[model samples]
Target: MSWNIFEKLKTVFMKVTQILVKLFKKTNKSTSLTPVSNVIATPTAHYEGVQTATIIAIPTNIAKAVVNCCLKNRIDLAEAIFRGFGYGNTKIVVTEKEIIAETSSGIVLLDPSKYRLSEL
Candidate 1:
């Protein structure tokens, strides 16, 4: 009789422990799944007569979008549209202001003033 009671108590205890463990696991997963912000601030250096700083921090997706837009549209049209979209690419530069990229055409300024850098 006492043995039967002990078995029942043990089963209940094990089930409660499992439930607690599952709850803790779920809580941990939920915390880990929280989204992270994407904003980045890169150090800038000033120079005279055609700034020659290398842009190594532009996001890959933004660069791809600029390249794709340039490839898909005429230079003037792409420039107009991308400028409206807050970015543009040419033979020399991708985007303007802060100078995010450069090409064989020459050095181009990736201007952060044109658009929100955080969005990029």
Candidate 2:
């Protein structure tokens, strides 16, 4: 029993570490030597903020997708999480009318609130 608990903690820690690494990786570009792009396709502020929410602005869309995947696999998404390094602080949660994917990308939409805390 203790061993199982320890393993779970270890997995969670590793996942958190990997997420942090991805979120704050060191860039090797030196401004003096590197070239800047003229087409500013990406907005830096937004990228540092809500990236996941930007990917799928309409929550219903991602919810539908997650629901479809769950139905096809016959898996209880609330109980089964993809233990992946790319995920964030929590786990993916799915319900009949809502979806929470904070663990997957640091994106959260709680009731009337919608935003991401990936920068921390």
| Best candidate, lDDT | 1
Estimate every model's Cα lDDT from 0 to 1. 0.35, 0.34
Error of 1 at 113 (Å): 26
Error of 1 at 30 (Å): 20
Worst 10 residues of 2 by lDDT: 111-120
Question: In candidate 2, what are the lDDT values of residues 49-85, reduced to their tens digit?
Answer: 3232222112232334344544445544343333221
TM-score of 2: 0.27
TM-score of 1: 0.24
Which stretches of candidate 2 lie above 4 Å from their native place? 1-58, 82-92, 95-97, 101-120
User: Residue 16 in model 1: shift from native, Å?
Assistant: 47
Q: After the best TM-score superposition of candidate 2, give how far the Cα of residue 115 lies from its true spot, in angstroms.
A: 22
